[model samples]
Target: MPSPSRVLKLIALLLDYPSPDVRAESLALHALIRTAELPEARRDGLAALLDALCQGDLLDVQERYDSLFERGRALSLLLFEHVHGESRDRGQAMVDLLERYSAAGLAIDANELPDYLPLYLEFLALGDAEAARQGLVEVAHILALLAQRLAQRESLYAQAFEALLALAGVAPELAGQCYQAQQEAVDDSLEALDRAWEETPVSFTDPAAGCPSASPRRQPAGVEQPLQWVAQPVPQTHPRATR
Candidate 1:
């Protein structure tokens, strides 16, 4: 079983605006998901997303992508929007994130910002497993929010976000609504279930598996850098639940 990092990489592509190149790789992407060491449900949901991408007219698919993500701040692909909104702090946060990615050996194309979720995921995909999970956990609440909003809109894109939450090892069903993901409880049953699966974190794989949408920006691995700076600007996030 390949590491789940490939799933992260693929999910990044799934989340991005569809391109002809992306459409062309549909078959390979499906094969990759089919063989990933994921739970049946995760694999199925991902496959359904791929199906949505593949089975529809190209124009229709592109329109749907624009409708869900491009039209509003609610589902912005940039991670900071949910956290910083239009604040000045978002500017500094962007600089900090770019430096961290630079330290990781990934370059920022003039066309892309450092905080875009797919680009961020690509950086996580290139590194070791623990780092990737930490990257996801750092933004776990945002992922949940995106998942919840997408699911509410009945968008297949929700599957990609939900799959990311699973990889982050966040508790189930806390989609969006500004829920604090780390605060969610993982009871005995959930822990045992996790143990039963015992999956490893996503790590770098063969270079051939790279997704084309964002790969043009990747350089070689640089000195590994810690993202300690990617702090969660903790807000009034989650309500405490009583046991």
Candidate 2:
């Protein structure tokens, strides 16, 4: 197994958008990985990815990253997108995850969601090593599916997910199942991509139409009750933190 620190650093670097700085960082990470005593296959896989990132044209890397991650939802970096897409449950999950981060004293930017893969890795980096491994295991299926999809696209980024699976101890049979399930979930055709972007009518105006009923109904004049308020704790901010 790779060192915990190295694994965390590699994941963070892999998730970043390719740039001159990232290219430099990839080179540094590559050197570190070369010296580490990891399994030959695992080390080679990660090294190959780092090599591609370091050698590829920056514009090409940016375009490929956008096409694979930005345009395609199947290979999204947001962990919850695969688990709970645009559902009320996903919103609740985010709220709960944010609370967990707060409890752990991890501050995230207002614009970044809690389920973002990099942010999640940052959180793990701050915790116990065993706990971090367990956290990765919790989402092993997602990583496995993403790796398979990226490999099909011949993306070097797929190695990052493969490394994650190794660290998370995902079984080959289980990974296969996860990959098959995700494949069955979406149509990867050009027609499907076009259809996904087609505009639909807004339907939020009608209160009685399909929307959930509003909570805390107003009381009649005679039944009015005194209002109660509960103060919410503000999230701590860290401007200097890389994550």
Candidate 3:
């Protein structure tokens, strides 16, 4: 069976398509099969919904894109929820997705990202501390992304502040570094956003270079960076846990 992360990636891709017909049809098909629902009823309902939505003027393209993106995100999170507790190895795979994708440009939901908090803390306490640290890094990067995107929006700034606070609660030292980086980036983004607003908000026709949203590439084979950063010390809590 395909992993939950793979399935979610597929959902994210379908949602990112620029064409309405492509987006709506793919989503409807996914919902029908994923839910194991009655095909006829599902098809009829989806058809009506798509027809009504398609009748809108092409000028509303941005609205359609946002709606489809949000829907796909909701479905991906649902898939992650279903697989999170099924098996530790498999659950870790989804957690791996959370770690890698929550980067500076990827728009991850702040609320949804916290779902990994318990798993992250538990893993640090029980599994691999280095691995857990990696997860925290991803969360920090996501916060930075949010702060940059919401630099001038008061609501976004508030939400990003809360997210930073939550991250600090997890691993204070690491989160503090992330919060500082995000604050600096936010300041820069606001300056850019302000200039753009006076003229036209900047838009990009291509994905950011080296962005994780294009799919994470394989890491170079070697000792992990964090392992190099900190020496492995004798466990203070569970001296016996470290073999």
Candidate 4:
């Protein structure tokens, strides 16, 4: 067994190492911190450990993790060869902490996070549709806030829309009902806009009232002409329309 004083000294050294080098030292720190008998000692060591994790440089930032790992392991008995299993005490919690830490880091740049759809699709395969839907919605919300262009926003929206469609499949009638409700909402919005226009003074109406036939079309204040909306007749119903 390593001496308690030596372990405390090593912990201090580990805390001072650069962030990219932390992973290589994690197992050793965990072993030392767990073996320590004093609660204060353990607390201090774990706090340093968590800080190292949360503030670490990007996992693939330098694309030199393996090299850094070998170098750091050379200085301490980090036991890189040991196999951790689910039965190991605190193993699951440690794994969760690591994953959450990684996700939190990725989330810092709202737009740059990796494509999460593939992992989510895997989750859906396991029959966790609800969880998958929730994840997609969360991602969509993030993308909506970050997307600067219509193209990117549309891409992210499509993912959420597909998940929503999958959800709607579980309730077919509700899907149709929701579509009808959405259309009704749009119609109501247009009606309200028309009513508001009607309430405006006479001077506001002529500019809005001009038809395509109104020649040397009067340019209404703040309205651009050649007016963009030109009404065309709808063709009479025929077999060609069905085709």
Identify the runs in model 2 with alpha carbons over 4 angstroms from their true place: 178-190, 194-243
Pairs with backbone N, CA or C atoms under 3 Å apart (clashes), candidate 2: none
The count of backbone overlaps in candidate 2 is 0
In terms of TM-score, how similar is model 3 to the real structure? Answer: 0.26
**Which lDDT tens digits does candidate 2 get at residues 153-202?**
77788777877767656653465452343333345577765553341212
Q: Across residues 25-134, which tens digit of lDDT does each residue of candidate 4 receive?
A: 66766566555543453345354544445453656423332222222111111111111111233334333423443433322222211122222222222233343333
lDDT of 1 by residue, 113-215 (tens): 6667788888888788776777776666667767776776777888888788788777545433334222222223545444423322111222453422111
Report lDDT (CA) for all predictions. Answer: 0.63, 0.59, 0.31, 0.29
Once superposed on the true structure, which residue ranges of model 1 sit more than 4 Å away at CA? 174-243
RMSD (Cα, Å) of candidate 2? Answer: 12.1
Candidate with the larger lDDT of 2 and 4: 2
* Overall local distance difference test of candidate 1: 0.63
Weakest 10 consecutive residues of candidate 2 by summed lDDT: 226-235
Quick one: best lDDT, which candidate? 1
lDDT of 3 by residue, 57-104 (tens): 644754543332222221111222221222234444544445533321
lDDT preference between candidates 3 and 4, better one: 3
